[model samples]
Target: MSEFVSQLSDSLYAVFQSETFVLLNTVDQESGGPTSSAISWVYAVDHSTLRLALDHRSRLVDNIKANPRVTVTVFGQDTIYAINGSATVTQDPLAEVPFKMCCFDVHIDAVRNALFYGAQLVAAPEYAKIYDKRAADKLDSQVFAAMKKA
Candidate 1:
């Protein structure tokens, strides 16, 4: 919807890949105060949406139900992509404890470039490889393992 959103798809993808953890910021359900959690269970559903698979025990799920407003901050190469969106939770059962999963359907509202020097930094030749490795080695490992079991 904004230049920040339109132009940053590739850049955001890179960040999403390399970053082992993204900061999920949400407000407290009752107090309406800010809270942030380092999460590794999120992925882009599309350009305008993201899906997060989180355990029901997290307060983040409750916060989303109370107020869908959320901001996901991804980082790498000293660059930050803070994606603003709303969330929709869906119940998904798991074999492990806490059998419920909150699959958040984030609707993109804005993109804030959290950067230094007023823009992005120069990327290295191995940046893409780094991205790929992080995606498979860290982020997707859980999902892949689950698929293998299935």
Candidate 2:
């Protein structure tokens, strides 16, 4: 991958790991056009593979099935990264669980970082709350225990 593509992938991974959402665009094969769709729910990311949770019936899915070409856009505080790649839909029962778990872990890590850095401005309120609660609960039960005891 080129530096720009690598940066875009890293930025996307960061955003997905935090927000669990992204703006996904796919190219229409027959018409050779682009269709933009908001995929706010992603299943996970393992290395370079980005697994998104989308309806099998949706146009975006259809578009992807027809043509694996896709572009994913992730927004940060001051920077936006666009990733161009190919996506393949998988229905493998055995791989499903692990893929979802990986995605969840990435999200958890993102939540922790966002809370730690006070970068909740770019996240949805409910998402921030969920992550904040997780962080608070973890700290309360572990690192912050000494302070509470003191």
Best of the candidates, lDDT: 1
Question: Best TM-score goes to which candidate?
Answer: 1
**Over the stretch 28-110, how does candidate 2's per-residue lDDT look in tens digits?**
76688988887555533543555555544567656777887777665555444455566654441213322221111111111
Instruction: Mark the regions of model 1 whose C-alpha exceeds 4 Å error after superposition.
Output: 1-3, 6-8, 17-19, 92-98, 116-150
Q: What is the alpha-carbon lDDT of model 2 when measured against the actual structure?
A: 0.48
lDDT of all the models against the reference? 0.66, 0.48
TM-score for candidate 2: 0.53
Q: What TM-score goes with each of the models?
A: 0.68, 0.53
In lDDT terms, how accurate is model 1?
0.66
Worst lDDT 10-window in candidate 2: 101-110
lDDT of 1 at 4: 67
Per-model RMSD to reference: 6.3, 12.1
* Candidate 2 wrongly placed segments (more than 4 Å): 1-3, 7-12, 92-150
